[model samples]
Target: MIHTVRSGETLFSIAQRYNIDPNNLARINNITNPNEITVGQNLFIPLSRITSYQIKNGDTLYSIARANGILLNDLITANPQISNPNMLNVGDTINIPDVRKEIEINGYAIPSINQSILNDTLEYLTYLSPFSYQVNMDGSLSQLNDETLISSARNSGVAPIMVVTNISSEGGFDGEIAHKVFTDVTTKQSLINAIKSIVIDKNYSGVDIDFEYLLPEDRDNYTAFLRELKTELEGINKTLSVAVAPKNRDNMAGSLYQAHDYKAIGEIADRVIIMTYEWGYIYGEPQAISPYNQVDKVIAYAVTQIPSQKILMGMPNYAYDWVIPYVQGTSAKTLTNRQALRLAYENNATIMFDTLSKAPYFSYSDSDGREHVVWFDDALSIGSRLDIVTKYNLGGLSYWTINNFDSANWAIVSDTFRIKKVM
Candidate 1:
């Protein structure tokens, strides 16, 4: 359940009502200073399936259990108020356990991710994909220092996925490099062999191919490559997943979208992660990173071409602070969800929510007297995105990067869905 903060409500007061420790509540909600919760902010009340159902006429424990698809023994255990199992009174109320659907949660992490951050994040993830092993020009993979990540994931029972990208050393997607690997049979085979070798050598559970920005002509070739990679991974009992740009329709014209044939890749790969963020990017005018309205359109179109169960909607865990009078090429300072809150607190900014976008933003003037706009995800916005997962019946969600941990987001995630573990 989600509780909205009222004018006089404090975290301690909220905890008291829930009959839980205030510290635990703060930890789960990422409230470092228990007094910092803002009005209108949503706080997850970590109730354990405590939904109530009123007893109707002719209601019995057995009937209630059967009707709700719960075991009779469990029903009795939940309603310990009843002294006799055989007796039931009409108009009596009882607790009904809310059922949570199991779904996979994937997080992309950097090799240089903080050990403490990774440790805190693994518990809520089904698969951890380190970003990434850059795909070299000759179909070889640049070495990734992922040994520690893989080891830690194993200890935590989270599957570690090897991520390969068509990123050149110059720090951008190299379309020429992708074209070489996809069109040349020898290079393609070599690339596949390299991926398989790393998976087996590193004991990785799977591979996530994130090849971005390819020539429009390479669309079919890209899908063909994924098909080959999937076959090779399947032979070794490893999974194959792909990350594609958010495109609302097929044949979308853009370097990022054209090469990603979602329908074909969705069929070939075990999972398809639709990158739904970056609409509000570093260089662009400030806006919500993953606006609900925009994300909804992408998922709606995706389900038409790909099986909903195979799609993993992408979510951003970061926020952007854009300077006012935004220049076309000026860069926005990036902030983690936690840091965003801290900034708002420091500035005494009353965070505002855009109902249409379902995102949180605020404006503040720095000491330099320059006005700035900050847009970020909060419990409410994150909750709205989580709802999309269930709404689409999609496989699950994948965080773009998990280097930064957001406790309230995870709290809502834990409260709403069960994270399915492969191990």
Candidate 2:
């Protein structure tokens, strides 16, 4: 439960009313100035469930819900506007209704159609990228392969989303070229044609646009493009979603943040997934992958701009381990949260959790005798972050990449809330 500070209410009074200790309340909320609570400031009130599970790669709502003996409807009611009920990606969080029950967990398979993996773990699956707008000159597009993945997803009761990225190459997204194409009128028209052709030709139910690293100057252009895209897609009863940088407010100054106008995107898209994870990342300063305190700040500011109902928080299923006595420009190595824990155990290092940051970190020396510090998420850290969704009443969450899977994260989420699925 959350309470917005009202006029003339003291922390002590509020805690007494809630029957919680004042210091406990402060600690949970990370409130430094408990005596000076401000009006309109939101505070989280701890309930019996203080944490939740984070959906990882290979997780689905159906399996998670069944494992917890939760009805699918209960999960859907918890989160509305989930366009595809059977599809879940990495970083998605499904609420676990029963913490103590042993439940089945499922995830969608991406390639080689791993039936054995699917049979073993995934209750539902989603095939990505079979439906996408292929760029063409003269405002036209050509259809790509469609039948195989769709057939696979449907056969397993999994729903599929048309994943379209601004990928000039086969592997990843290229934001620079996308900005050029979207900002140029002729190119934009051609892009639209491609989108229309793909939607019509492939019979996709929804579209997911993953455009990244866009220039700041193109903020208005990006907003305008999304608006037009939404208008076009809505006419046919199709859903539209755009991936955006996680930002606190509109005036956020970074190139990535500036181009993604949350307010504008929220108004235009059916769902706006905030790419929240990345703090502890490869090529980044060693830190917690998604520090709870940092994420809270972003969410706090985001709620002010976009409606909580339209926001889908982003989660990271990966972690990073950095060698210490660091060079000025050296990068950290990417590690799974599970791997991070194993490393700590293997190296005989003690794992420590940060109260203020709500992250986990440990220090150790590598075989080469180089000192290192590793920070990452665990069941505890992931649970703490998921709590923000319920406290803030967010729409849902999205994952960065679901290639790696984690079991403990799923267990915690399955215990707290039901995973919502789209009908």
Candidate 3:
């Protein structure tokens, strides 16, 4: 439980009231100076069922849970309630319950796989890319990795999805390539045949079509392609999902937004994953990564076009730390959510939450004496986003990429709701 600090409340007094160690409270809250407590700042107090665990050599929560016969989520849910689950100490005695059952937690795995990283995540969805598939001029396709990752995911009870992209080797999503494959009669047939072959050959459970940058004129063609894909997939008892740009209205402007045709896509696809996180990014102006206002706007319009149960809200697990005296063309440095918080702590900077945006940011200086502003997600920010899921009664959330696991996110999610698992 979180306790909001009041005026003149000492750490010792608060700890005594809660029956917890003052030092432990300070350390868990990342407070070096226990005497200095800010008014209105929320402090997480460890409860009886929520405690810390110390890691032993060659120890994993999976093995521990298996031996203890407790589900990983139960073990995680019983912990001291720290934001990041990945931030565990070697000798801490974490909270544990007596049981053996797994909770369903879905996560998106990008086409790029780092096995070590994948093994550490608690996601149930593994999205494989057709972009990585070798497509021949004759319209036949070749498999990559011999389906090594796909097999691994299935064995682990994670569903493998085929992710189709409109990207060309040059860079970015190419409209011409999309038009050629999606609109052109022969190419469209070839693409469909290739998709069918992959689904059958690889035993894929679903398909995620992520075609972007199509011309507005090709909107019908895009929709047509999705309808055909869905029809074929449904015949085989497989699912069809799409990744779309966040739109504020039916006629939201821009080629990216306009061509999406949310209403049409919703009718054809099983689930639509909204790409909602890039407002503050590498090439864009400095801003909140997933500002609450912007996200709400997208969700507000999306519900009107699609069924709320089929909308998967997008959440970013990273942040951008931009250097001061912003250059118009230079890129911003990317930092994980945990790294952002650690940077603030190391710099003795206070983290600020924007009331309007419902986002967390911190300003700090680097070793080179360069001032920087970081806009990232934290437990508080993530909690606010997850509220949208509950408010909209949406299907679930889809992480853009879980390559960088944030323990805080998992903790907050575990506290909020049970993740849905298809497998």
Candidate 1 displacement at residue 206 in angstroms: 1.0
After TM-score superposition, the amount by which residue 154's alpha carbon in candidate 2 deviates from its true location, in angstroms, is: 2.9
Q: What Cα-based lDDT does every candidate model obtain?
A: 0.89, 0.66, 0.74
lDDT of 2 at 355: 83
Task: Give TM-scores for every candidate, taking all chains together and pairing residue i with residue i.
Answer: 0.90, 0.68, 0.76
Per-residue error at 178 for model 3, in Å?
A: 0.6
Which 10 consecutive positions of candidate 1 have the poorest summed lDDT?
41-50
Candidate 3: Cα lDDT at 67: 62
The top-ranked prediction according to lDDT is 1
Q: What is the C-alpha lDDT profile of model 3 across 113-194, one tens digit per residue?
A: 5777676564534343223453343444445553766776777767777777776656577677777766568887898889
Query: For candidate 2, what is the lDDT?
Result: 0.66
Worst lDDT run of 10 residues, candidate 3, spans 98-107
In candidate 3, which residue ranges exceed 4 Å CA deviation? 1-106, 111-113, 123-146
lDDT of 2 by residue, 1-423 (tens): 556567778889999999999987765543545674544344566556523467777767777666556677776666564678777667766555443322112232344444453342233222232434434334344354556655555555545566565655454455666776776788787777677666666566677776776788888888888888888888877888777887766787777777888877878887777778887667767777788888999999888878887777887867788888667689888887657766765676666668877877889888789999988766567778878888888876565554555555544555555555453
A best-first ranking of the candidates according to their lDDT comes to 1, 3, 2
TM-score for candidate 2, please give it: 0.68
Model 1: colliding residue pairs: none
